[model samples]
Structures are given as structure tokens and as C-alpha cells.
Target: LGYPCRDLLRAWIHELDPDSRQRVVGRAVSAPRPPQLKKLAVLELCTREGSAQVVAQKLGVSRPTLYNWKNQLLG
Candidate 1:
């Protein structure tokens, strides 16, 4: 997704309640061999293909924070 589109989707997702968030996460988890799991799945979808800016926006976090998480996960 483009930066603006991703940002909008991120905001929309962030505004959802816990149950809604859980539903989205559950869908991601159920996808066979998905690259994401749990919190990571939420992040991946909200980002729409691992776009750092989108992920940060959805997460209400800075780009550096997203990078740190990625590093921790991949390292």
C-alpha cells in the first residue's frame, strides 16, 4: 500500500476495541504458515506488507521502535 493509504488503514485499525483487534489477529493467525503470529500478525496486516511507516502509525510508535522490534525478531 502507499504511505497515505497505509496510514489511514492503520488509524482505522488502531481505533478498534480489544475484541475487534482480537478478531483481526485471529484471522491472521489462522492463515496457514503466515509470516506473522499474535502481535506480529496485527502489525503486519496494519502495515500491509511490512511497511515500517504504516506499522509505526498503526502501533502508535516511532519508526525506530518498529525497526527495533524487527531487529529483535529477525536477529
Candidate 2:
């Protein structure tokens, strides 16, 4: 695994109930972003909207950064 604990963490994130996911994203948006908060937006986009385009636009990340984060967290 690119990330040693990737599978476990992904599983846990995926398993979150709808309300929980929303709450997590809610907190994430208010937190710092760019690098530190990239994953939160990626997770939210993947689980809810499944849109990479929006991730780039919303998170102010470049295409490569968005794709890299997606591969890292959602591989």
C-alpha cells in the first residue's frame, strides 16, 4: 500500500454513516486547508459527489494535486 494504513483508514472513512460523513465534512471545511485539509475535501467529494473537478475548484488545488490526493486517500 502506498500508505501503510491506507486500507484500514479508507475502510473506516467509507463505513461512516451518512450523518457522520456530513458532520466530518462540516468540521473539515472550517479547518485549515491546501495541504493539511486536502484529504478532508477529497474524502467528502469522493463519498458524496464523486467529482474530481469540484475538488480542484473548491479546494483551490491544481489538477495534479487533486489527482494525487485522490490516489493517496482513495486508492
Candidate 3:
């Protein structure tokens, strides 16, 4: 399957009940991973206008988080 399909399936499976998922896989499954923010992408967004508030709001993260990501990425 394509990457998109695999990602979709993975997301769908992650949404399944833990018991059902364990039953299907015959083993314990870890919790779904959090969304990862790319350092470069975050830095690039920081460069854009209205990124501090607008972009951060759209991304569901705080404005300070954008700065933290930028600083960490640069260091």
C-alpha cells in the first residue's frame, strides 16, 4: 500500500479500542504517538507573518511553543 494508505490505516488502527486492538494483534499495543513537529517546518513558520499567534493557533500549540521549537532547532 502507498504511504498515505498506510498512514490512514495506522491512524484508524490507533483509534481502535485497546482490547480490540490487542485481540486482533494478539499482543499489547502501545498508545498512539503524538504528532511530531518538524524543526525546520516550525522555524519556517516562525519566519512567516502572523505566525506567533495565527499559525500557533491553527497548529493548536501555544505561541511560546513555536519560539521554543525554533530555539531548540537552532541550537
Candidate 4:
């Protein structure tokens, strides 16, 4: 009864669509991670094919930078 309005709104959303909260607020509420984690994620997607360019683009870094991160993290 203290915060029925807010609680009811969340409950309604949950009842209508269980995934609505995730779709609407999950990413928004996520805590910011370090750059190393992002670099590692991008590196994991890298393959022997043309993935370097694609992943590098996604990380906002150059191809050489991606390779550098790979060496830094893996080697």
C-alpha cells in the first residue's frame, strides 16, 4: 500500500507480458561494464574470415586495434 501505483503498474506490465520488463527496462537498467569486457566480447566474435572488419566496426576500433586487443588479452 505504500507504493501501490508503481507496484501495480509493474504488476500490470508483468501480467500482460512477462517479457515486457526485460524488453523495456532490462538493457536500460544494466550496469555499465568495463571496456575490457567489450573488447573480449568483440574478440570472441572474430574469426579467420572477414569477421575482423565487422567486429572492429562494432567496437569502434580499427582492425589493427582489434588484433592488438586479441594479443593483449590472449597472449
Candidate 5:
């Protein structure tokens, strides 16, 4: 599935109530191999206008790691 833009994602996350966030986390945990929360976090960070280096630094992940997650999530 195509990932939504960062602005949209931020808005969605901001609008989600605590209960809804729990449901999302719960759904992720239900997967056979639960997806990494960091991967999802990286994806969100990429939506911002930051460069790869900045995004990775902010998230404390490598640029390659962010790129890998971006491809996996977007592709």
C-alpha cells in the first residue's frame, strides 16, 4: 500500500485517541512477526522534509536503515 504523506500521518496520529493508539499497537503485535515500532517511526520521520542524515540522527537509526525501511514500507 502507498504510504500516506507525512503531514497526513502526523494529523492522523495527533487525532488518534489513546485508545486508538493502543489498538494500532495491538494490531501490530498480533502479526506473525510483529513489525518494529522503530521501522514505523522511521517511516513517519521520512515524511518530514529533513535530509536522510538528519532523519536518521533524529531517530537514532542509520541512513541505510531508514532507507531500507522506507523501501520496504513504500514498495
Candidate 6:
């Protein structure tokens, strides 16, 4: 997964109930910063030719965030 998706997932997890959030936070705390979410999104967008809008919608983030990811990947 890519940074974009990981960020979105983190945001989603944060929105959950306290107990659920704690569980997720525990798992995430031990995880690396650039998690699979970033790689997955990059692969999905590059290899599968997915759209930024679709990815953003699914990830529940703005299109600008997706664009930032794309820019980061391209750079």
C-alpha cells in the first residue's frame, strides 16, 4: 500500500470507537511508517491504471491527497 491509502486507513481507524481504535492503534504503532497501504495504492494506480478520484473516494480522502501521492511516486 501507498502513503495515501495508509493515511486514509489511519484516519478511518481513528474514527472508530475507543476500544476498536485502541486495537488498531496498537497494531499500527508497531507497523512501519510506509506501510503496505502505500505500496498497494501505487500498484493499483500504476499497474491497474486506476483513477485518482476512485482511489480518493474509496479511501475517503480528497483528490489533492491522491495527487500528492502520484507526485511523490513520480518524483
Can you write out model 4's per-residue Cα lDDT over 1-75, one digit (the tens) per residue?
455788888998899999766445453344554777766755565654656778778666667866776776667
In the predicted model 5, the residue pairs found to clash are: none
TM, every model = 0.36, 0.40, 0.43, 0.40, 0.42, 0.41
Predicted candidate 5 versus true structure: per-residue lDDT over 1-75, tens digit per residue: 799999888778878753454333443232232368656665676677857788778766677867777777777
For model 6, how does the per-residue alpha-carbon lDDT over 1-75 read when each residue is reduced to its tens digit?
A: 545677787877777743565333443233332646666666666665667778778765567765666677777
Total backbone collisions for each predicted model: 0, 0, 0, 0, 0, 9
Write down the lDDT of every candidate, Cα atoms only: 0.57, 0.66, 0.64, 0.67, 0.67, 0.63
How would you encode candidate 1's per-residue C-alpha lDDT over 1-75 as one tens digit per residue?
A: 545687777677777743464333442232232344435834574458657677668656567755665665655
TM-score between model 5 and native: 0.42
> Which segments of candidate 4 are over 4 A away from where they belong?
1-35, 47-50
Ranking by TM-score: 3, 5, 6, 4, 2, 1
Model 6, poorest ten-residue lDDT window?
24-33
For model 5, the stretches where C-alpha displacement exceeds 4 angstroms are 1-36
Which structure among the candidates has the greatest lDDT?
4
RMSD of 1: 17.0
* Candidate 1 Cα errors over 4 Å, as ranges: 1-47
Tell me the deviation in Å of residue 66 in model 6.
Answer: 1.2
lDDT of 3 at 11: 76
Candidate 6 structure lDDT: 0.63
Model 2, 1-75: lDDT tens per residue?
A: 366487777677777743454333443343335655766866766676656777677767666776777787778
